[model samples]
Target: RSASNERAGRRSRPAERAGRAPAPRLAAATPPPAFARLGQAAATFSAGAAPTSRATRRSAREDGRRDASTAGSPLTRTVVRVLEVVPTRLRIALAALVGLGLLLGAATVVQTVRRRRLERQRRRLIADVGVLQSALLPEIPEHIGGARVTAAYRPAEGLAAGGDFYDAFELPGGRTAVLVGDISGHGRDVVPLTALARYNLRAYLEAGLTPRATLHVAANVLAPHIGDRQVTIAAAIFDPGMGRLTYACAGHGPPLLLGTDATPVTACSSPPIGAGAPTGRRQTTIALAPGATACFHTDGLDEVPVASGRLGREGVAEELRAVGPEGDSAELLARIVRRSEHQPDDMAACIITALPGGADRWCLRLEELEVDAETLNSGWAERFLLACGVGRPHLGTALLEAREIVARDGTAVIEVRVGEALAEVRVAAPPAVMLPIERRPAGSSAAAEAG
Candidate 1:
């Protein structure tokens, strides 16, 4: 009877139980969007999968624990959360920047490699060019035609090459030819001309032409093509047979005679070739005694700096004298460099030392000049005759004859040979090639005056 009544009371309290509040919930609020989606994916994974054996399930659970541990790391979790929230476009742009940086690094490496290769090639080419340029100024032999020869070539500071050039070679008839000259400018425009002038002068000298004649023809040949550039050349022909060195200047420094006290002949100084002046009109010949040395050089020696002023010819002579005949051209240049502060131009020199007892020393010197007959006057002739060391009586006689000869011919060549005892002056007709096209001014003799 009690069991039946309990059942009837439980049924009657159903409505009250139903009206009471449900048990308190474990979680009240919804998860965030990222977690919510993750939970959904987990539910789907659980429902779609087939049942697995115990061993597989155990391995899966172990992997899941490991994955959870890794995901729980603070830095990793933060990075993952940031990535999940980041916009797709921003991620793509970041990827593009990384790829571009990689490409740029590769390009930079390639460019650097190319630049190094080019630098190596440039250095090699420069070295090769230096060798070729050296060929332009050759090494002279120790002796030519029984005369000791020495030479030196020094470009200006910080230069590989310049206009200065020189050569000494054996000529026909047991003679030797020496040439030294300087161009006005540098670079491609002048290199070929320098070579051309040097070789051409040598050929002319070898072809049995006098030093004055060789320069005369070269002046006319090179003048028309030189444009504004000019060349100053000093040439010499040594006849070991005659023991004489006949030298001439084309607006160049006079040759320095070593171990001699006599003054250098400076009469009838010729102007430079290409200067439109009467070039190669004057030449001087001197006797080179046994054991004598003669130096042929460019104007660089005269242009050095000193305490008083520019180191002129006298200064250069002093230096050469100090060096003495025993020294060579290279040694001479070295001494000059040590003494002077600088060299502004290219320096080149050719020195010839005569063998002792080579030939009889005449103590004879000669000077010759080609003058315009129409322009020849008494005053100019007097100065020239006096400069030639002609005495009063001979001067009067030579002047009278020069006037008569000039009246007869268009031009006269005055040949003066000075000896230890006497001076011989002879006036005669000049060669057709030497006749001047125009009359010289009255004071043209000023440049010809001797110091």
Candidate 2:
């Protein structure tokens, strides 16, 4: 009886344990409410139910979820929820577009900044070029050595300055020398060569060398220095006492001599300076009478392109004649420059006109006189006297007289008449003071008698 009872107890215990284990398993396998609804909809679709409106479907899902919560297993209810805010392709395209826009904007900014920097550098370079040009070419004297001298220089279009240059300076014994030249090219590259040639010519002439000899010396000095560059020069020495002009040319145009007859003084012609071995340069002397004008110019004037053809030497001569002999040197040259139609090269010219009357008739009108004596030393009076071919002694005497007159008369309009043998400084207005000036001949140191 005891053994049978123990067996019954054991069997009952095993059955109870099996029942408890199933209860725990069912609880763990139960699905959530949302996933339970999803399973019901999937099962309904599989059963071939007709599709319904979104609102009807949503209401049906809610009602089904209530039933499923009570009936479905826990494991069948739980699921992951995924929401797509933007389409994958759309998002990728938008990102790419935004990145491309940023890249282009950066590139544009860099390009604009680079352009502005280049512009600034270009302007600074142009300014520097202007300064250098001014230094290389200074204003020349209007009158020198008993001649009315005037010059006109025109650089090539679109250039600040060019290689064409001219200079006129006084020599010993009442003589004047003029130089006109053109280097190979225009602008700053040729400035050094221009300066060297101009100054060397002046120095050689000042040393009492003849025109031909001066040119030879200049060629010798410049040939080795100028590299692959050519130069054309026309040099003239005028002696007012003798009324003679001695000129030499090196691959340059002939000087135009205008008087009763228009003639071109084409005496000497040699290879251009620095071209090759120096040729024996020869000079020609021509009588330069009063009321006559001599025009020296570079090839720019003759090489101007016209409708017919280039304005040759004959055309240049004709233009000069049309300017008329009575015109002032300054006015004449200005008119010629204006008439040029197509000037492709740098133009430089010098016009020398002998005064019709003697030096005595040369009049310099001073509107006002300064109080300082030093002003008398370098004023219109002195410049006019020097232009009138006054020697150093005569110039000193003239300045002394001018100083005395200015001291006596405070501020007055004075007329200075520089004659060959005398200089008269007289006040034109009230408080008049007349200072007579007597000048001795050249090479004589006779004290000037002043009254």
Candidate 3:
């Protein structure tokens, strides 16, 4: 009975406790402002998380409450309480708007920077084009190789420079050489080739190479870089005293021979360089009379469009004929270039005209020197020719035949040919010194004397 009475007493005490409100819970007693602060913090966290649904917001709310409790500072608690006074839904909306604004602003900044960079790059490219143009065009001289010279340079449309280039300089032995060349393709790629070809040709010519020999050396040197690129080159060396022009061609356009009679004749050249090695190739020798003019130009002349597509060599020749001889060479070149309407391709031409003064008639002084046969075969010959701007062809051939002639005989006669005059070279030689050269021109003769 006592145990039953104790159980009833326990039940009755719990019922009494439930009947009275458990004095308000501590969380419920928390001020509204404090609740608002916690709500705002929860929204901030939730905005960052972007969970699947509003239900997940509870996780953020719990995290916020823990952070507030752990803070332990009275000032932080007061501030948090103030923030909590804001409505939870409104707090969440504000945080989302702030986050979106920050993201949009960041994207705009990145895009603006990219645009500015691109504009800078564009400016740099334009400046680079100007620099390239200046370097490609060089100044030319009015006189070359004891002759008056005239030239025309036509730049391609929309380009500051074209692929065509020409040079004329006097070589040793009173020989003068002229070279005209065109590099394939256009733009900066051609610029380097122009420089290479121009300098190489000049060096070879000045090195004493025959026109044909010069072409050979230059073509071989440029072969590695040519790849698919081909070069059209025409070179000529004038020996006014000999009244001959030694010329070679590597697929370049033909030159026009402007005679004193005002008659225009066509001078042909060989195949273009870089096609292959030329072993048995022979140079063309034409009689260049006093008061005669020769013109060399790029194919851009015939490249202009006609109804039959691009005009061929025949068409270009015809055009020059039609322009007539009375016109100045410079004026004629300008007319053709203008006629071409400034072709899309490069156009350049060089003119070398022999003034009325013919050799001795020109009253030029001459000097003669007698040297030994061994000197002709020795390195001295090469050095001498190089100084006079002559002898490259002789040097290359001399090396090959030097030993053969040395075995044939121990002594032979050597001669020096100067200004159309040949002088038998008297050499003091060891008995049996062999001389390789046999044929020599006895004296100067006007092969084709045109009245």
lDDT of 2 by residue, 139-195 (tens): 667667867777767655544456788888877776778989888887667998889
Q: In candidate 2, where is summed lDDT lowest over 10 consecutive residues?
A: 361-370
Runs off by more than 4 Å, candidate 2: 1-131, 159-161, 260-268, 325-342, 357-451
**Model 3 quality (TM-score):** 0.48
User: For residues 262-341, what per-residue lDDT tens digits would candidate 1 score against the true structure?
Assistant: 55568657788888776787788887766788888888878878777788888877888887888888988887777778
Model 1 vs. true fold: TM:
0.67
Span of ten consecutive residues with least summed lDDT in model 1:
430-439
TM-score winner: 1
lDDT of each: 0.79, 0.67, 0.62
RMSD of 2: 21.3
State each candidate's clash count.
Answer: 0, 10, 20
Please give the lDDT score for candidate 1: 0.79
Better of 1 and 3 by TM-score: 1
Across 123-164, the per-residue lDDT of candidate 3 in tens digits comes to: 676456545643564555666555666666665655444568
The C-alpha TM-scores of every prediction are 0.67, 0.52, 0.48
